[model samples]
Target: MEIRDAVPSDWPQIWPFLRDIVRAGETYTWARDETEESARAIWMAEALPNRTLVAVDGDTVLGTAKMGPNHRGPAAHIANASFMVAPQHSGKGVGRALGEYVLDQARADGFRAMQFNAVVETNTQAVKLWQSLGFEIVATLPEGFNHATKGYVGLHIMFRPL
Candidate 1:
């Protein structure tokens, strides 16, 4: 699979996967009822300067990632990112490839480290993937995420120095 910069046109292909993931209310912190227009705005913002990407194989989009300053003003040196893979492509290394690409982009952009502000504890696949990529769970917010199925689950703050 190859990783590339995402253009505005790519959103048409990305929206379905993004909508499915967010609607599931299982992993991402985005509003479950988010509209396609709003999601498009957010993803496009990520495509600017220090932001997003898409993992593709020729014409097919396998996954996507967005990277940016982890915080504002004084804390901007650190980076942050999010990822999503097409449900059909899960377990095929799309997430891993996207994670690695985002990290490399962050480092190249001069970030000191990368932080995931809210990783749902029950999402074992993501937790494992981040840990495998060298991120450590710095803290876990008690009963942070109200998962649709798991009820309230902890949200982990993961970090890795670049």
Candidate 2:
């Protein structure tokens, strides 16, 4: 699969899986009823230094990722990113490729570090992936995430120097 910057045309393919993932309320912190318009606005970043990318095989979109500054102004040197893979593509290295790509992209963008502000602890697969990619759990807020099936769980703040 090839990873490339996403285009508006890709949204038609992206929204279905993105909607399913967000509505599942299992991992992401987004509102369970996230609207298509709002999601598009957020995911299709057009401003400078912010990017949205897709992993595809032929015409099929396997996964996506968005990356930008963790915060503005003085904190802008740190990068932040989010990822989503179609359920059908999970366990097939789609996420790993996106993670590696995002990390390299962040470094190339001159970020000093990468920080994930809210990672649901119950999402063990993701926790393992990030850890394997050299990110550390810098902090965990007690009962910070209300997982769909696991009730309240810790929310981790993961960090790694780029």
- Find the candidate with the highest TM-score and give its number: 2
TM-score of each: 0.96, 0.98
Candidate lDDT (C-alpha), each: 0.90, 0.95
User: What C-alpha RMSD separates each model from the true structure?
Assistant: 1.1, 0.7
Question: Mind giving the per-residue lDDT tens digits that candidate 1 earns over 1-162?
Answer: 999888888898899999999999999888999999899888766534466688998989999988889788989989989898999999999999999888888889988999999999999999999999999999999999999898999999999999
Question: What's the lDDT for residue 154 in model 1?
Answer: 100
Runs of candidate 2 exceeding 4 Å displacement: none
Q: Which candidate is the best by lDDT?
A: 2
Which sections of candidate 1 miss by over 4 Å? Answer: 46-48
Q: How badly does each model clash, as a count of residue pairs?
A: 1, 0
**lDDT by residue (tens digit), candidate 2, 24-82:** 88888999999999999999989769999999999999999999998999999999999
